[model samples]
Target: MKTARRYLASEIYRTTIAVILVLLGLFIFFDMIDALDNLNEKFTFVSLLYVQALQIPNRLYDLLPICVLIGTVIALAGLAQRNELVILRVSGISSKRLLWMLWLITIPFMIFAAFVSEVVTPYTEKKTSEFTISALGKNSTKMDSGYWFREPVDDAHYRVINIRRLNSSTEIDTITIFEYNTQDNQLSSVTNAAKGILQHGELRLDNVTTRTLTSNLAQVLTNEQAPLESISSLKTQKTISFKTSLTSERLVATELQPDKMSTPDLLNYVQYLEENNLQANRHIVALWRKGSYPFTLLVMITLAAPIGFVQSRKGGVGAKIFLGILIGIIFFMANQLALNVGMLNNLPPWLTALLPNIIALILAFGALYLMERRSKPRNFIHAK
Candidate 1:
């Protein structure tokens, strides 16, 4: 049993590596072609290639399920075509045994996927985005100057409405706030800060400029094109009390997007949201999806076992491979749809994450069940 397992594992590993190289090469070629349009004097082909290279781990993580589906199927189908499966089955190797063997073989792949998703992909993706932005130079949006939102007050309502970016640790890169007068529903002030930080629900602004506009003042400003007053004062303290309702939750929801967050980051974000009584449905779903992604290798490989039952005399290996590809595509689509549904409907994250794998396993077992049942009367043990 150990020898057989080793042989099958070795074959699957070789096939999977070959498929990954082919798929990775094809994908990077297209990425290179796409990156060409963005190339310039500063963002040369070499820099663009560097950016594309940074994306390799993310691409590999994305391509894992597809490669596993194709590779495992090809390996098993080859065995079937060569009569190895027939001999094994005759020696009392049931579909259940093959299923276990496939799962065992897929364990290392699952570990690799987890590593990519948890560590490598996140860093590389962030680097790719930052590099692209920096490489593009001053063309990027550098915090809106005209940004504002209602700041609720008994007299002057204020709300820290928008954050442009989390430029670095120990500081908020940029922000916009709106202050309103409750008496007449009039705009009192528009404030933009070059940099700020949130500490205990208050936004402390640095290098802020406030513009208080009225009809006459607006006309004066429009006509004069006078230098805008940079609001610098001791009384203002350059501090805006952020609504207690706002938290890091909003930052995570917007700038720190779920797709861009690693598993640990997502986990921490989810806990923060729960503690703050914020709705974390999307983040929760994303976390589970990341957690379950590694196991997709097992599901994809198990799915290939059903195709291995097909003898060369009945169906060409190409058809079996096509079948594997079809199933892989369907499972991938189903997984995506399930994630969306979970987020939209507030369904259990774990259930949504595990649904595709569970369905694939059930179907694989069902197909093998039928195949075995049909072959029972023929007594092919000796015949094959």
Candidate 2:
């Protein structure tokens, strides 16, 4: 059994690697074409190629499970085609043991995936973002204060502006807010002399003037701005100011971009997102989706083992491989759909992420079980 297991494992590993290379080639070919249009100016061929290469790892990270499934299915199918599985079956190789061996193959892949996401993805994404900005000749794109984001809010659009500044110690100093109306899409109200300071475990923005047009006849009914001193009497607060010498790690929480965050950071951010009435389900789902990868490879192996061994199955090898691809595509779609729906409907974060895996596992297990039952010999009796 040990010898047989090693042989099968070696074959499965080789086949899986081959499939990964083919998939990676396809991804690179398309990505290079996409990168070509941006090859001029800041996006040079070298930078573009490097960026694309950096991007491939993340893409591979995302595509790992499917790749595993395809490779496993193909490998198993080949063995079945050559009647090798039947020979192995006659040598005391039970379906359960085969499943266990497949699971073992996934363990290493899962560890590799965890390392990739934890150490590699964040670094690469940061590099990619920086490359994009540097290529465009922008010093800094982060709009802290004196920043404005315009978007449609309710019946009208507003250009929300912040006149924000940080002290030498990297603390929020003075913040000014401005709101522009979209009815005429003109600057209607300017709320200035505002500030953001740390207060009672929360980042508080003071001197706020929630202003708007009261009538369609070009009139401002309300424009209010209060000073920090006015709100100072409300509580005991430590004056916080921004310092210019702060690093990214010190000023911003890593959880802001959960995908770029490490596992621990992602988990923490998910908690923060949940408490803040934000859509954490999607981010949490992504984290889960990433985390589940190595296990997924094992699942693919388990799934492939039975399908590959079924000599009397109706489908041809191409058809079987096509079926595997379809399954992969469906899993991807279902995972994405669950994320969107869970975010929109406020479902539990973990459940949204686990939905696809759970479904796929059930299908794979059931198929494997049925195949095993059929493969059992007619003269065999229950040992119990």
Best-performing candidate as measured by lDDT:
1
TM-score computed on alpha carbons, candidate 1: 0.76
lDDT of each: 0.72, 0.62
Instruction: Give the clashing residue pairs of candidate 1, or none.
Output: 149-178, 150-159, 151-157, 151-158, 151-159, 152-157, 152-158, 153-157
Q: At residue 47, what lDDT does model 1 achieve?
A: 94
Candidate 2 lDDT at 73 equals 79
Q: What TM-scores do the predictions have?
A: 0.76, 0.70
Model 2: CA > 4 A from native: 137-257, 267-281, 312-315, 377-384
lDDT tens per residue, model 2, 25-104: 99989989876887776568898788887787677777877887888778777777777877887777777777887777
Could you tell me which 10 consecutive residues in candidate 2 have the lowest summed lDDT? 228-237
Candidate 2, TM-score vs. the true structure?
A: 0.70
Task: Predict model 2's lDDT versus the native.
Answer: 0.62
Span of 10 residues, lowest total lDDT, candidate 1: 139-148
Per-residue lDDT of candidate 1, residues 306-348 (tens digit): 7866677754889888888888889879988988887778788
